[model samples]
Target: MVLQILFIAIALAGVALFSYNLKKVIRNIRIGKAANRTDQPQKRMMTMVKVALGQTKMFFRPIPAFLHLIVYAGFVIINIEVLEIMIDGIFGTHRVFGGMGALYNFLIASFEILALGVWLGCAIFLIRRNIIKLKRFSGVEMKGWPKSDANYILITEILLMTAFLVMNAADAKLQAMGAAHYTTVGSFPVSQFLMNLLPNTEGALIAIERGCWWFHIVGIFGFLNYLPYSKHFHIMFAFPNTYFSNLEPKGEFSNMQSVTNEVKAMLDPSFTPPEAEAGKFGAKDVNDLTWVNLMNAYTCTECGRCTSVCPANITGKLLSPRKIMMDTRDRLEEVGKNIDKTGNGFDDGKSLIDSYISREEIWACTSCNACTQACPINIDPLAIITELRRYAVMEESQAPASINAMLGNIENNGAPWKYSPADRLNWAKES
Candidate 1:
């Protein structure tokens, strides 16, 4: 009973910390400009189910996909056992759910298999990131904390699974000896192999079991706290992010309402344009982008899949869609932190355009949408790129001479060519 009470206190404290961090994250996300994603509820919900839950986009690379699926399944499914652990901890009970007989055995067996799968998946991911040294894993953006973050998750997951297996192994050994309170409860087909390494004594087995139990649960709580500081927060944010993803056609761009209104009045000579509020053109800073854009920032897995498929990156251009997303998130976080520190209303002088993302990098994009398609979580870095381009062209009129010429031609000749519409047929002859 004393141990049970102590466990409850620690668990509640962990829960409190997690909730506080989660609230701060939500506050940061809300700092972004408003965007309405409330339409098409059924469609959005279906997308969340299929894309986030089903992981439909992950299968684009079969090997990583399969391995990721195993880890994802283990992470999700093993939490069911955590619920039982919580029950046992609170009630001072041993094998509380063991009363279910065959069902309990099946559950235990399945958990053992999943725990094994989790370890296997983590091992391979570690090898790929460190040993084989996959190119995507080693880039300018993945230096320092990013690389360490990946390694930390992989190592911690492996250790947690090992702890679980060790506990099961000791428990199985205890059961074999008919030890009191240890109970012949769990079926440990996988951990049974570890039995020979463990002592047959009752006291030693109990100590082993308790130590592993404490480590596993405490580690889980620590991981929960670690997530808000890491890209691994996507494990929780992906669902809502996918649900709120922009459903516009991939090829379509969202024209600003201000631009649309101006064009309408220009087309109709006598039409009266509404009194506009004089909004700033395009995305000069994090505040200029929509809340969904900010949500995309939070949802980024930093997986480098977007960068891997980028034609610009492949062709040796300065642009990397993955980097674009990271920079946006980083800048947004900086702005948010500034706001928190100064207790002011969004007065950060550093904009995302020149401070974080460069003009050359934004302009290098072909707008191919490959990055958007390749993203497993539906992150559209292309959208952020386009908005930044809009800022350069409209807000600052900073487009290149060649682009300026094209824009002038369109305004004057209704096409990219310098010639008038009447001379359009002369192109073939001139060539």
Candidate 2:
């Protein structure tokens, strides 16, 4: 009963802390302008299923994708055993679902296998990051906390899986010994090998089993709380992020409704424009971007897959789509902290543009959708980049000379080129 109470308290506290952090993330995301991602419910569901759940886009790099899928599948499937653990912890019962008989055995067996797979996958991933030094994992944005965060998650997962297997092995030994309260329920196909390492004494085996059990559950709670602060938050956010994915063609850019209304009014004098809204022409900060844009920032995996495929980055340009998302997220976090310190409408003289993201970086983008297509969960770093560019051009009149000349030509000649409509036909004459 004492242990049960302790478990309940620990679980409740863990859940409460996680909820608090999750609320902060949601509030930060809501700081951005409203976007209509709620539309196309059916299509969104399909996208979530195909991309986030199925991990269809990850297969672009088969080896890493396969390893990642193993870890991903293991994470989802092994959590079923956590349910049983929770039940046992709360009720002070042994193997609470053992009554399910063959079904329970099958579940435990599968979980054991998956746990091993997760361990192996995470181990390989660690090697790939630290030893092999994969290019995608070594971007400028991935330095410091981002790099440490990835390592922390992988190591923690490895430890948790190890504890799980050890716990099972000890439990199996206990069952064989006909120990009290240690039911002969689970099938330890993978953990069975670990049984040889455990002590032959019953008391020592129980101690090891109980210790591992506590460690595993506590580690899970710790991992859950750690996620919001880590890039691995993608694990949870991927589903919703993919669901709210921009369904438009990759090359298509979103137009500001305010600008659209103004254009319509100018083109058709009879067209009544809505009441003028007081806001910046384009995104100057996190608040100026759409909620989906902010969500995309928080959802970035920092895998650098976007950066790897970027033509701009490939050609030695300052623009890294991955860095754009990272900067947005960093800026959003800074803004969130400022708001927490002051009130809701606080400003610290720092904005995403020219603060976290540089003008050179913004202008370096070729406007290609390579990054968007390369993302496994469909995170659109390009969307954030374009918003910053819009802010620079419209609000600050800070576009590059080439872009300024092109825009001037379009405004004056009704085309991107300086040639008049009549003169356009002269090119055909010359041909």
Q: Which candidate is the best by lDDT?
A: 2
Task: Write down the TM-score of every candidate.
Answer: 0.96, 0.97
Distance from true location, Cα of 257 in model 2, Å: 1.6
**lDDT tens per residue, model 2, 186-303:** 7889999999999999999999999999999999999999988989899999999999999999988887889999999999999999997889877888899889998998899898
Q: Give stretches of model 1 more than 4 Å off.
A: 426-431
Model 2 weakest lDDT span, ten residues long: 343-352
lDDT of each: 0.89, 0.91
Expressed as tens digits, the lDDT of each residue in 1-431 for candidate 1 is 78998999989999999999788778878877778899999999999999999999999899999999999999999998898888888888887999998989998999999999999999999999999999988677899888999999999999999999999999999888998887788799899999999988789999999999989988999999998888898999899999998788999998688887888899998878899766688899888888888889888979999888889888888888988888988887787678679976367668899999999999899899999999888899998998999999998999988999999999998999788899878868885
TM-score of 2: 0.97
Judged by TM-score, which candidate is best? 2
**Which regions of candidate 2 deviate over 4 angstroms?**
344-346
